[model samples]
Target: MATTVRRAVLTLPAAPLGPENPLPPLAAPGDVHRPAVPRARDGEELPPAMARRMTWAPLRSLLPVRRRDAYGRHRQRTDLDALVVENDRLRATVLPGLGGRVHSLFHKPSGRELLYSNPVFQPAGFALNGAWFSGGIEWNIGATGHTTLSVAPLHAARVPAPDGGEMLRLWEWERLRDLPFQVDLWLPDGSDFLYVGVRVRNPHHHTAPVYWWSNTAVPEAPGSRVLAPATGAFHFGYERALRRVPVPVWDGADRTYPLNGQRPADYFYDLPDGERRWIASLDAHGHGLAQTSTDLLTGRKLFLWGSGPSGRRWQEWLTEPGTGGYAEIQAGLAPTQLEHVPLHPGGEFAWLEAYGPLAADPARVHGEDWAAACAEAAGRLEAALPRATVDAAYAAWRPYADHEPKETLAAGSGWGALEVERGRLELPGTPFAEGTLGEEQRPWRELLRHGVLREEGPEPGPSLVSAPWRELLESAGPGPYTAYHLGVAQWHAGDRSQAVRSWEQALRYGCAWPALRCLGAADRLDGHPERAADRYAAAVAEARHARVAHPTATALAREAVEALLEAGRAEEADALLAGVHPTARSHGRFRLLRARVLLARGDAAAARAVFDEGFDVDDLREGERALEDVWFAVAERLVAGDGPVTEEVRDRARAEHPLPVRYDFRMGA
Candidate 1:
């Protein structure tokens, strides 16, 4: 039997490998070379070649493979222990945590996101020191994000005067997590403060152009009677005062307005100077809520009361028929576009109004008691609003306010690490990935080809799309234009059912031009051609009567005319287009419609002549493609059944026109 002798194995710890450490360096120039030591049998040195191989080669050759594996495992354990020591040394020398102070943290149930402060960094221009607290109002920011409100300041003002006069400002604060956002106001006293206890949804930073209404909910009771001073007609189309006699309520016989058999509409009015409007809502116990707003500088008062119904029964009481009411007072700010005001970087833009609970009858409480109650209620509202904190507030607010936070990568995470092991990926290789690139390219190429509109001045056509139109449609919120644009977007996106729903909803509130057109288009597409025709007709009429002028109204009216003509109601279409003042150069399209009507009645000669003349006289520059389409349809019809090309048709076809040929002759096409 052969006996095998085993030698005891020894392991060495791994040394640190860095410039400062005395561990073995990686192979580099001028490094020291150490002589190898070899194992010997019974004090006899191994062969020179074997000794060199043992020193440089892996352990597998000198011992049984399994024994070498054991030796390798022992070496790994030793190296791991050394690494643990090195890791602790590095930790001792490094900075441990972030440098900033914790300001606040919030957990929003709706979004389910955790917002916390980082102690390492602070935003410039402010300081924060506070414990994270909960329980605040939720407000929508720009119709997309929600922020919490902590404290709402009742008053705020700027330091310097821009117009060389004393300006008093009032603002309301929304403590968004840690940051503070404000809503500013200018009161009569020249002293301004933040507004209190109002939810402003879909607020813009400095560029708010959409319409907003202040919605207030008041508690109601059976004996509650509302009194509102009206200047003119109510904004809603309901009768302000209904009486048994035809005499006007202005004749003044106690104006006992009754809501017993009638539905009251929402009323809005402006207040006149030195006028005080009152609303008395009395409960069975003789206690009720009264709201009042005073123009401290002008001595005007505005008031409103709850009507106990599900909705407020609005009323207008005019001290004078021509003027004097809340409507008049508010009118000063009417046609109010928030973009007109100059707001500071983080400053907020807001409208102001005062509201509180008051006694139904002035005699029920002493003057001092009424004042005290008003002040107390106002104070509570002030406390419930949001306020701004410094530095860390911004960081806390943004994480919660952003639309999609989960998709954002953590700082220092490499892009390469985000890829899946086996999947196809499409990365953006260039900017201008959106359709905006096409818009930019078109104008540049146009300028290069046709040259600039004015060699050294601004371009002749609009350099930018109208902001008011875009703002009214694009800004998030339930507004006239927003509803209108939503319908249009949905319609264009091929969601005809949804588009119809949106347009119908918009019409219930108030009719806007785009909304009416969209509704008509949707109705037409959904097999309600008659209803669609009615909508188009109504839109044209409304545009003609609109108080505010819009350029798109003309295009919308023309579309309505076309819709009516295509529906085989040529007489109605003619009557509508008759009022439109088409220029000599632009009358071709309208005349073409007329020719179509004549052709449908089997008057080929008349239709052919009308089309020839209209087609020849029109500029047809912008809608060249449409012009060609019409020409093709007419030519195809005339040339049908071997009819010769008439002189009028041949001359018309020779005109320079460029358009594709696609014609729809169906109802309301």
Candidate 2:
């Protein structure tokens, strides 16, 4: 014989029978026409008159059916009696609202049919619901009104697996009190994967509300790539952009965006537009997962990935201001900031996004047609179109690199940081003015137009010369060349005190030719002949170290030789120029300096020979240009005068040269 299973039954107190009840009316037709009577309220019992007034009226008369009981005896009762008796038994044994209402019922003996129903709403705005199956378990759902603006629902179900194991489901919901929001979650069918979501709506005017962010965990194996479209490259905050890592500029290239390579503490605020519309895929060996977020309204895409265990705990939430207040949108690994959108009043935002598993062969991945298609798509979305706006904004934030200034001698307060011929010049930590001078090369061609630096000014003076230089220098940061130029400028301004101070500071920081000239000039002015010689020697040494053609260094050496000769140190000055061959010897100033040095040693023949070799008969008749004239006059006195070249001859030489010749090192050969 086969054994049959049965459910245990419990009995309870009977409910007060009345004609007004649907059960009694179904059982007796005469009970349909009933005289209603007022019920007792709070501590009051029903009066006999009221009870008698509630008696049923005979609206219709019908005979009851006769049926055979288990004992084979005749029972005077109809099918309606059987229904009423079963209903009474149900009412007596099970409470009406204990297991909630029957939302939907299915008689799925074969377990192939699926049925669902909308949740029920009760009169007091509370609903109790359940689903049951024959020979199976029952699921119940209930709700309770907590306050005027809050309500909570509870759900209970028994989930059966194909393996005969059963799981119990228990979940709760709490509607926000006095807020236009509700949160709910469920362990549907008692599965480990929980379905969670939140709905937020505002009935009044639109306003920005603060939403709390939740920790989202992602799990995966190693070798997963997270792809996203960034405005530029990811900043680790340790170094400047583009220079920090090996990322190419906004031009389309195959360089890594440096997203996954960043440290955990690093955060990206405004990503480049190209990188924003990215899709990141995390793959482990061959098995991998891909997630893409698409804005339903704008159709913008954001791609993300995860790996190594944390991927499983990943969740997405939309929240309001309160503890434990949020709506869980996604329950698996998902990219953050996927669909950041503002919700407007009476506006609905929906996203059409997906997550799926993929298998890729590592050897063939890069060459695969599918991989090519993905890359092409990514390039089209992020790499093809130029993000001019984003690039412009980023460019605005980047530090500028201006050209080195040209002449620092003519320091003017109105001079700008940039100029056409000269690049830029300003005191350290001071702002670049309207007009300045700078180097010959176009340094900022990559940033602006190549000819922008060459534009002429409206008028003459500092404004005409300094404007371009100021523009270029204002864009640049502190550099060695800039400091050197500034020191020279200080020296030329006749502020020898300040000039020496600035040059010393520059040397302490870094030694350059301009700084050396300032040092030498300051030493000569301060009567420190030894220090001036040392500065000139240092300049030559640095020039050799740099191994480049530096006119400034050569000029400083020449000046040092003259100063030594003035101090009656002819042998020392000659020794300084031992290996240094004079280039551009045809220049009038070069011959003049050589002539002066030769005359100082009383070698009148050699001095006259230098003038003869360098100057033409007409050039000599031209009365010498400034410095050359002074030296030529001294030579005339040495050769034509009978005795030593006296103070009167020196005064004539000084008048010819005009004291300072304004040596320009920037002049071309």
Candidate 3:
């Protein structure tokens, strides 16, 4: 451990640049529920029990916050409280006041910034939630996009290191998720690499999907090139469609070249199947960043807005024009945000990623060349320090996590400790004017156009059919995601047979689990329960075969069990539910299906027990809650022989739990 020197606050002459555009104040992020308003069944509004299930969204304040003033300026300015740390080989600056982001990372040896440092603190309304700021490796955890705490302050400490090195730790208790995360960024004395270790803990007895992607932004200019270890990848597009393409070579154009044309594309590509790690970008002179984790499981993602007019408009929209647009080299834990791994109750997730600068002559030009470079690069990094020194440094790391720490920022202020701490930096957030609503259109459109699963709805277009166009989308080498949407377009056009055929082709092209799940939903909606069950089963199989089981896959398995129960096939339902993970088995839907199965087998007492016992309904949405209530009500009526579920019982249950037509991840599903 390094000695703790006398702490001194220094006033700097120059300030970091502020965002060109301030984030518009956000209203709490929640689904835009198009609820079929509660109808009056009786003269007395169904006597409360028949009332509709509520749309109780979690408090929005808990998500990442970007308070806006009357002119839409981000309340927390980026110029102040800019904490700086450095070593012999590298230097890092942290903006504690600006969401605690590592604002800049410069390699002293190469005099190059390994990470992009936006001159302006620009935030985009692009997150799955509402607020997102670009630049640096922003820690995105909780749901898929930006975390609630992304913009808020994180409790920060510049921990002392005995060896004259720097170890600054940032920790926070995520209020909405009931989880705590700690990120320790260590720059050892004389070391070339910056070590980032993140630990997330879920202490609740309920399971939920946890998301994280270390978003690294690097300068994308005329001389830059990308390198990853894969031949081909699953490319997710700007229109929220999918396709498979050879890595760094899409439409036969080498994507590694920074100038890959102006027909803008946005995609998250899955690298080749094997034990691989590292995703890098280097300029023509071979100077940039190479990042990797302790484990080899990482996805290489590229976000390139075309050089075209609309694309440039978006580039400036996100930041500012003339500042020059940059591309993203994201290292993710999952292929797509839709298929994140589920974190079990009381489970812990930990990972270590290293960001180091690299330079090579004639630099890597393709995926194959890059993979070879990574192997040598990894060895060189490991050889930087003694084995014991590296091992002891990490092993001695202590954790600081709290879910209910003492509140600061003055009583009733509602700002968190980090926010208060951020205030100490001198740049303060301005309060919004009364009745001011956050600008949500940009975020909503961003999701609709680029996001999968959690978007608002299908991109607006004719919901009717065009046979000739359908054949073209299906046959013109469209990616799986593109094909799936094509099938959807066909289905809306009154071509069910063609839709199925189109979807199956994408399934065969390695679209994996999502395709099968989509088919299952369609079949079930079409009243083909047995066929849907088959599709769900196949989808579940694919999910299980992945390095880790996916959330939607298990959710689909629970759905399949429901289908079997609906078909009065108790044994089939029982067998399938048995194979699901315990956490999934505890889902309210699965338990209700089990209860239904028991009732079908004449086990009234057992069925009642399933309902009487507590159901883990903590993380479920309105629909799931409604389904649970309805099932329990039905079961109670059947068990008590209460004269065919009287209108009173039906009304009460329906009122308590009015499920949407479908409860799923899909927009509007």
Candidate 4:
């Protein structure tokens, strides 16, 4: 059959991605990764310059960190719009609205699903903003963490392909880095592989830091082995350190097997320079999925949620029960996901990736010798689909990349269009048309055209903190609303003192709760926790007096109560929590705060009872140990045995009271 591309609707049980938090994300949450000493790979010293570059331009803050925590466990069967690209030997399904993810890739001849297609649409607090789902191939672009666009849409259209067929192109402007990127997926006639071409363009006059990782989720079964063209890897676990270790075998076990480990971890394969970049996962029968990309996309990695209880629980939480487990084989632009490559002004990085079924001899593929196994898999991949062929395909797709869309398959956000209008960017291939602009961009568009931001709504809408937007906000005439937004932009730009000053100026003009909350955050960051608590309390009080029962008010209460508890003012925290609106008190996050307050007030039983009441924090962050840690703290208090809590007592509590499976979201052992 000839290659084809068409639109379709897929029905799945999906949890609603609720409305975003109204608060502007001033500072970023703590970096989840713990600082680990850099270990030499294969006994060779990592070049000093390269080491420094890897850590350069780490994200401090960015716009649109919207909290997607309002979703609940209730899921209703919903129809999602999707695009399918197929050929004689393979079929690829793409969800344009959901980050343009390759939702499914099936090997037709083998009758096997090459990717771990998720069965349900469950949004979790995994993305840099929030609301990320598992499975399929996720295009992770932007900073070190998952892209803020993980759950957002991408502009999708049908573009002419080199093989005279049509390729599905998904493009969007990534606001975090202020760059445009596109992913074009097509299947060639009579080919078993699905070819994907990705391009990230820096249209600005200055250089920008860029990160891209194509995360492909493949099924994981017992005896499954992941192979790559490397003998060693930079192993990073939830413990927060990247330590170089030997491939296949590490810490007395073959770590390549997903089931061999007991925690969530990342193994960034240290591929030698000039080596073909590829990663594959094969089952006991030696039949599985493989992904190979051009040299420009150089990194390859394996991520596994191991056989531990927490890992297993996470797997179950991400999908429906009885659904099999999966592991990720990722390819990126850097050696590891921790690094961001520099894209010079007007420079663009483009590469082609091919994913398909790979069959090798089981013995050699999972052989005891890691190098031999990798060589065997690499040889098979070369024989099946040569690297030269992928390169030629990329070359062929370059000209067609500029082809205008024959049909618009889906619509993404209006931020791209707003950026295009503001900068007058002439991107021929990926058009961010003026027609796509929506309400979110209206105020900013007015500010761009005129000189003032008309904050004309009950709540301040989304924020834009890009360099150009900041410059515009600065030039606009001064006012309370302008100062509030200007402070947000300043905070994102790392102008901490100026941001605080601007927020204070806004508060003096009677800009009540929002400015107070921002000042609270600044105080906390400046190491004045007591003053931070006071600011937060004042913010909450102002919101209460105004009778603002909006989500922003709820967010304020949560932040204030936590701050009060942190300042060891348990009575004040409890009083503030109790005075909040009933809806806010019933929220899962607020309930967690209530429990914390009770515990701080020396009421451990009350805190324990809160856990026993069976509440679920819909926006539980990935790798968050809050629930587990609190459970242990409560357990320690309960098991105090008439003595003050000590190290031995804590150990005894942990030993005597095993963490309930429902609350166990620990990322490490």
Query: Model-by-model lDDT, in order?
Result: 0.30, 0.30, 0.53, 0.86
Per-residue lDDT of 435-482 in model 3, one digit per residue for the tens? 221233233222233442221221211111224334444444445545
Whole-structure CA lDDT of model 1? 0.30
Over the stretch 240-345, how does candidate 2's per-residue lDDT look in tens digits?
A: 1111222222234222222332121122223333343323333334333332333221221211221111111111101111212111112111111111223455
Candidate 1 matches the true fold with a TM-score of 0.26
The predictions' CA RMSDs to the true structure, in order, are 35.9, 43.0, 25.4, 2.0
**TM-score for candidate 2, residues paired by index:** 0.26
Supply candidate 1's per-residue lDDT for 77: 17
Sort order, lDDT high to low: 4, 3, 2, 1
Best by TM-score: 4
Off by over 4 Å in 3: 1-78, 160-166, 261-276, 363-669
> Which candidate leads the pack in lDDT?
4
For model 1, the stretches where C-alpha displacement exceeds 4 angstroms are 1-477, 492-494, 547-550, 584-586, 614-669
User: What are the per-residue Cα lDDT tens digits for candidate 4 across 1-669?
Assistant: 657899899899999887777788666755564235443434456656556656788777757556666666678999999999998899898999999988999888889999999999998878887789999999999887778888888999988889998789999999888899999999888998999999999989998999999999999999999999888898888877767888878999999999999999999998999999899999998999989988999889999999999899989988989999999999999888877789999999999999999999999988787778888899999999998999999999999888888888898889999888888888878988778999888889999999888875445678888788899999998777788988998998889999999999989977788889899988877889899999999988787777664677777878888888778999999998887789758867788887888888898999999999978777899878788888898889999945699998899989988888888888887
Model 1: per-residue Cα lDDT at residue 455 = 17
Order of all candidates by TM-score, from best down to worst? 4, 3, 2, 1
- Candidate 4 collision pairs: 34-240
